[model samples]
Target: MQTPRPKTRRTFIKNAALGLTAASVLPRTFAKESPQPDMSLSYQDLPQWRGFNFLDFFVPNPAHARVKTPEEHFKWMRDWGFDFVRIPMAYPYFLDIDYSKDITPEEVYKFSEEKIAHVDRIVEAANKYGLHVSLNLHRAPGYCINAGFQEPYNLWKDQDALDAFCHHWELWAKRYKGISPDLISFDLLNEPSLREDMNDQHGKREAVPAETYHRVAKAAVDRIRSIAPNHLIVADGNSGGHVAVPELADLKIGQSCRGYWPFNISHHKAPWVYKDPTGLPPPKWPDGPEANREALIKFYQPWFDLKESGVGVHCGECGCYKETPHDVFLSWFGDVLSVLAERGIGFGLWEMTGDFGFLNSGRSDVDYEDWYGYKLDRKLLNLLQSV
Candidate 1:
């Protein structure tokens, strides 16, 4: 039997907050403002922005259980020594369309202001807490790495999709026109891999053709910069944020990489990624290309090379699931994060407050601390802060 989506069970009301007052809707349990973000670091260079990915707008449907994040998540992230939050979003969430209907291209461009304020609630909250926010289109008008929904057009192969992609970026740019780049940046897309079938999540994937990625990303970047001249734009590496794209280096944009290098270690039994998750061996640290520190360094040499060429790079997503052994997870993660930190590259762990986060991760081995009914992995938190 299939598990049910939490849309019916989540009873917490989403607050429609405005301006700095967004913080007022925070959980009554935690009463403290996030420190103002240090403007000392420039966002264009992609400062060592280490933090978690917020999912409030990632899927953006009640059926998908996505809603606005409480300001407390931001405050605690700030108090915990993390400085960034990457929000992977679905554009349609802000649109005035029925989620159950087959969406037309025309309807795709239209969005609801009231719905968008929910998004503003997140950005404004992140800003209020002094955290740098990077907005990414996990589900663009025509493309996304993971599968669940179908698009009428293919972003990688169709001009119509490309147009929609650029149009959305233009909308976002206009929406936050005067926002400082230091506080928020726009990540053009999540992971740009070519798929034979858009709805098949477990099928063999191909890296997006470099030339095609170059064209699509350039178009979106140009469109965004035209509106918000100082906005920093970053693109995920081809092939699931692993392979660096020199094809886009010439563009004045940042490139993003990932921490899930070896699926064995990072996604040992992720049900979506593996057909029979239980058949796989329990994950071990320093296996295969990660057999040693030097081997791991060699794996990311391409990313470092990209940075050397003056293109800013950051690991946009990295983390193990609740199923991975805690000790092994940290042991492997420590090396992964250290490697990225050494070269001045920052990272955003896959998620926060869910399967792959430091809160409510549901790991059997962790000595979880109680944070207002939420479980906190103090060991993992300490490991991340050490770097």
Candidate 2:
């Protein structure tokens, strides 16, 4: 049976703090005025923000080894020395009814309710553990960058879809206003790809204009900030961190930043997506560290050079696929950690336990104890400890 969505009246309280005071209000348990840094603070000023990506929530299923409650996730994250959790969510998953073909009004309302509850539980859990959390709209309410999402990227063209997207963020700002200083960041959207002039050989007609995408993103960002001031708002650069918004750059949203990292080696045999499908032979441990480090640094230089306000850099998602050799994966991580250490940039591993997770998701025959036992990966943990 599908899990029922949390009840709104029982779960959400109306007076939650948001807007400009979002980062200002702290829980009674923590100091209220302790020079708490905003997103705009220099990376050096706020040095304790080690983080990890919390998957499974968006891609929930019985087949996945599901953790029963939010508390379970927090306990594991805290024990592993993670200070922050980036919860990536897909709005489509929460729809009351399937609308993969055509969305309906009823599905929209149900989705909004489900999303609010999902955010509420996650933020509450983060606060319970005193961990910072960044809410990421991984797949916007109606669309995604992945091929699995309905094709032609209709989000840019459909008015209802765009409105539903903006409404979700506004509601979030209201629902999670004064939860905790630890709950201070919002990722506007995941990687959004748009092309202005493209060939459609079958139709013999040019596709729709690319300006629509720019307009949609700009509107969404503006709407979110207007209602939820003082929160660190992150805008994803185009795929591979290729695009930037001068207007957003000027906002200096302090915490608004970009993400980039080496995916080729890390995702060599990744099943979901890959740069090269023939699978570049996996690297050997300890020896491949230098090359991996070079790739990460080179890929991140553009964002590093941006001098705009509130524009910090983060490697939001990076990890080797589970299918790759364990020793090689560990080596790649070691190199990445070393580079992040030198640059003072923060990063969140792609997931906790799945195809790209640090822990085995039990789908494969790989022995977690023998390959990534706690002791064997101590150096990697220590690197996170340094953060």
Candidate 3:
């Protein structure tokens, strides 16, 4: 990635102007002013929250190859009118150094002071920028969404894995106990999409039903609340945050939903999403907005019920791949954002930079310019700002 340019006064003004333009044409659903919904979860009772996931350069252990430091990232996000940052992290960075082929429960449960300090640095930066930090475990002990890969333990089934996972959360809760929930929150796992048919390397089907996820998540929540009772915990609704987990409603934790409905449009030709896009038909918005809306309403009905029951509902990950036509992407994005905002729900775009970000997502059809040392996707940025 190229070094991002410094944000200058001229750039800020230009961006602000673009945002104002978008605000003028924003869908009516999000245009109306409404009070934010009250939350039953005491820790999340804050103002309307909006931000993007910052996953750039967050790879496996010793992650220092990013284009910007945590402080720089948070500062930029805050200055751009964002109030939240979802930091999706891989766990290897926090694991013990002595581990080899076989990772023990000790290794899984242990956390290096250096790694904890690294996270602390991010949290401190978030505070400096007045941005809430949602620390997320994209890859956990025994399961991940990535296909054709397996972890040492299956978090949904193995007691050791579940215990280790809970212990890790416990450690985090203890570390950030005194911090206000306004400053920091924990997103226990990311995109828990397990397939009942898929087999792990050891030939075991690592299938996790909704009940299993509820159990593990409840246990983790219990562990966290044991110390930091007010800690805000979020669990990814299964299948990329699109599927609802009603079983988790009783847990009294927040649920992170996905906005990537009609995946062919959101993930169009994205390599990670499909091995072959040749067969996919082109997508158009408003072509079936009603159907799309119905799908979203149905998929999110349970979550809405949970919200009605007082649980906090949030769309933690939602964005279309850059390769999709810009107009189509915007049309789809507008609908999703409108739905979320109308419901007084909080959301964050999948990423702030790189493959699925607001800036420099490598869309071939779009023109770009350097802003803050990164290629600025002005239109997309404006659309995000408008909502």
Candidate 4:
């Protein structure tokens, strides 16, 4: 249900310009016009459903798992106007086997049972809330995008690591066989890196090649489908949402599609990756909506047309860091919502609470209030509902 590309780039450019002006500057007609599209699909097809990440499984214990029950989380999301949640998990975290550095065969079997149970809990919770979920392997058995995790495992070279990775997916497929299609999908991996000794051959730290990623991604997809034929599989784009278009153009998979999240906004001011930290400011809420719309268009246009005939394209993650001003965050989100409404793309935020989340992950019950206070960002939520 993808909307046809805007009438022309010129129309988009003009509308985009108007969008940048203060919301009041724009003619009331634009806002009054019905936000609904001619076609209908779940929030997944509405473009505005782009949402937040629920990263309890990846971050280490205490911090990783959200204290709020899935029911509480989903209810908050619904009230906040989000349509989906992206959950990232590490293979080793749930498994009994210590896939941490070195592991034995017996440990692998033990880990398998644990991993299965954990995934089942997540899927069941997501379904309970009527929210779509994307399960991503944030840290594979041996590899991770971050160097800290990569050193000990040497995941790329270890054969055992790769086998454990494959085995985990096979188990996951079997465990969630009957999960509802609307409630969940599988993301093969988080950000897959292509660094040689922590740096790419180009000397630039980039994601692994599309071919290598696709190879493993396909394997996982095949295995998962064998067990749960209906689960939608999502493949991530290479480095920073830069899809190797040609590489993906030739790839064909049934009941599966690909997704991407360029780091421009969400990772802005992120200390872990960005050196300056302050260079990329969080999006401003007061910024005119059109300016935000153009940014969204600029970021997504390159990969927009990549949606295959039957497959869908989802912007799996996007959000400004919590450090960014709340107004800035709201402005950016408003613009994103407008464009997504027009384009009908699916999306999710980087996190729910914590560093980049909507809720304060540090507190037990939305305790620490930002300038925005305990109340959710109502303006942004209203705009999302409008879309």
- Compared with the true structure, all predictions reach lDDT values of 0.80, 0.55, 0.70, 0.54
Best by lDDT: 1
Candidate 3's C-alpha runs over 4 A off are 1-47, 56-58, 63-70, 98-106, 147-149, 196-207, 289-291
For model 4, the superposed segments whose C-alpha errors exceed 4 Å read 1-50, 60-70, 79-81, 97-109, 112-116, 150-159, 197-204, 242-246, 249-265, 275-296, 308-310, 361-375
What's the C-alpha lDDT at position 385 in model 4? 55
How close is every model to the real structure, measured as TM-score? 0.87, 0.71, 0.80, 0.70
lDDT of 4 by residue, 1-387 (tens): 987764753354334433332232222121122232333232223233456777667643323455544566677676666768777876546544333455443343344343345555655666566777777887766666654433334445555555556666766655454455556667776656566654222334476666666666666767776776655666666663445333543334311212322344445556666667655654544346444456567666655455423335566765566565555555566666556546556566566656655455332233243433443443444544565
Candidate ranking (lDDT, best to worst): 1, 3, 2, 4
lDDT of 2 by residue, 309-375 (tens): 3356665666666565666666667666666556666677766655666455442434445443431
Model 4 is weakest, by summed lDDT over 10 consecutive residues, at 24-33
Error of 2 at 316 (Å): 1.6
lDDT per residue, candidate 1, 1-387, as tens digits? 998756421121111112212432222221332333434233336798899999988774545755558998899999989999998988777777788987776666656666666767788888888899999999998887877776778898877688778867876777665566777789999888888887798744679889999999999999987877776889899987789998897787888999986667788678888888766788787666547578779999999998888888999999998888888899889999999999998889988788898888878898989989899998988988988
Lowest lDDT block of 10, candidate 2: 197-206
Which candidate has the highest TM-score of all? Answer: 1
- TM-score-wise, the better of 3 and 4 is 3
The residue-level lDDT of candidate 4 at 74 comes to 71
Native-referenced Cα lDDT, model 3: 0.70
| Model 1 spans > 4 angstroms off | 1-44, 288-290
